[model samples]
Target: MLNRCIATDAGSFATQYWGRQPLLSPSGSLPRDFSDLLSGPMVDELIAERGVRAPFIRMASHGDLLARDCYLGPAGFGAEMPDQVDSAKVLAQFAAGATIVLQGLHRLWPPLIDFVREMVADIGHPAQANAYITPPTSRGFDPHYDVHDVFVLQVQGEKRWLVHEPVHQDPLTTQPWTDHRAAITERVREDAAIDRVLAPGDSLYLPRGWIHSAEALDNTSIHLTIGVAPLTVLDVVHAVVDTLATVGEFRTSLPMGIDPTDRGSMAAIATKVMAEVTDTVQHRATDISEGSATRLSQRHAQRTRPVAVRPLESLAAAEHAGFHPVEWRRGLVAHVDHHADRVVLRLPDRTITFPALCSPALDALHHGLVADATSLPGLDQDDAAVLIRRLLREAVVIPAKQPEHPTRTSRG
Candidate 1:
């Protein structure tokens, strides 16, 4: 339950935030204890139960004169593994001095998934979100900046950060190592704008393209880095070209004259076609932003099949009639099918359909309004028997009365 303090001084804060000059956030603590949120017991459980992968982490070299001490893999290995390390030892190393931890956040336990969801919301993007935790000893990453913006939250313990101002103002992309290494070199020579320490509950916001490094300062330091997905002009252009390729006009060859020396004319035709492609791509961004928008665009676990329904025990008189209940559980999306003759419903992630009339029964059971078909309204013996059979087949409804207890219990 990390508490976040958004910048209150909008005027001054906005002026200094993520601009050419570096800035530090006003120190604040999180609302909840991180230990309680991610207890040690839970950490062990995650490692034991969940098939967690540990990707190779990287570190920056001080100079060519020194040898690189590779860990887990090669200098730039990003392999995945399933193993738990000493949390205290990693924290101590960060406290000693280490920068960056690759694939650190993706290894988080399930308890932290909610926190990751909220952080993605704060970034104002619907992209899939993940986090990396850097203990004191381990540098999860190298002394490099990320291509996308990041929201760093100190969940527990303490960490120090050194932020370097952008050398190339408003770069097309951050983490210039992939494209603009020359620009990164120039910026590093210019000098860092801010250096500060962050303790538990403190958060630091770094816009994409800014250079920065961090190290743990406490015995156990845990932090969450929320990454923002970047949408580039090239991406838009590519998308537009792909869409236009369906048109015959785009596939047709340009009007090339028979004269072999008319190369200049061919160049002009190519330029005009490229311009059209670029324009279409620019407009297509709006469609990509709206039509495909998801709450959390990141990949998630595959949805499980709906629960099976059980027969109603109260409808003993009507052997032919059965009832089954299907619930639209919270945090899940589903659809209902209500026809004049039959009732059916479908889940967003599954194709399973249930009787539409069963919707009310599911609601009643989910809300604890009825113990079983005995408490349902207008559900006669025959209807109850049919509903029970359907629910049990779909796994959407369960027995209200367990064998251990002869009497009916509250429906859940």
Candidate 2:
């Protein structure tokens, strides 16, 4: 929830906790139900069913061959599992992977998915939210920092984090640089100033560029890392470059033949091109913001059709209590309100506006939690069908429960 923290003016947590100067808002607070979102048995099932995979380092054991390292060992159930079994297993898995990069929420265990959805909705950037879990006694990644800002939540067990001040002030640049592995390693060895253990319910905020590493404590640990994607000057530059590609001057090559003595003419042409590029870049931020909002508003499941049975008319009337519909995709959340005759969905890209009339139908089709058209009071069969078709076309309604009959529908 990048904007949530920004909106609440709590974006300065990095400065408050890590002694860095404040740059963004510092008003928002972590959700109180953060722990309840991840600690449970459903998580345990994911751990037990998963397998381990890691990179191999060369060893001199038998004729310069690579040996299999047992970082977290084979993924298996613990005999004396912690009370919060699922969270522990997820954390253990994360540690085992060393540097797990999660994308879509569909890859996450069901319980975690639910928790993430709620949190993203509350934070006001539901469409731009995602979570990553790590395993115990393992380090999935080498000591490194991220390009995006992150909020780390310790749901179960404990994890030890070693933090180092950022050496590169502007880390998230479009122009690539050589990996800073050697420098980071040297810095960590020199002075380990920020080292702390993150226990259950504990939270850490790491801005983009600050280097850090994590390892599980004695017990297995499960933690959720909520990453926020920020807009930057580089992003604007990229958009401007992309837009400039359509211009005739950008498409045409420079006049190289008539150059040497006509340097003044060529310079004037170059200046004109530069002016256009600069103007585009200057206005690119607004375009990026709108694009972001559009992405947020339109994000939803990719279901082709609704699966759950629509509620009966009597039951629909009895259970018509207004419930906010929340969706989580790619670590972002979208909150849907059925009142005010409008539906507002937010994401990292932008906020989308839709008619409130479509909220119930959209939620029913996307989440698969509420009943379908049959139960909805105002929606008729045709109306539900149209809405479902529209959402599917927009890539918002994803498949929910599989159809019982294999031949019932055509696959996308």
Q: In angstroms, how far off is 240's CA in candidate 1?
A: 3.6
Tens digits of per-residue lDDT, candidate 1, 145-254, equal 66666767666667777777765444554336447666666676665666777776566777776777766564546666656554555545554455566556678875
Q: Compute each candidate's TM-score over C-alphas.
A: 0.54, 0.52
Q: Give the per-residue lDDT of model 2 (tens digit) for 233-274.
A: 565555456655655656886666666568898788879889
TM-score of candidate 2 against the unseen true structure: 0.52
By summed lDDT, which 10 consecutive residues of candidate 1 come out lowest? 295-304
> Can you tell me which runs of candidate 2 are displaced by over 4 Å?
1-35, 39-43, 49-106, 117-140, 173-178, 258-272, 279-412
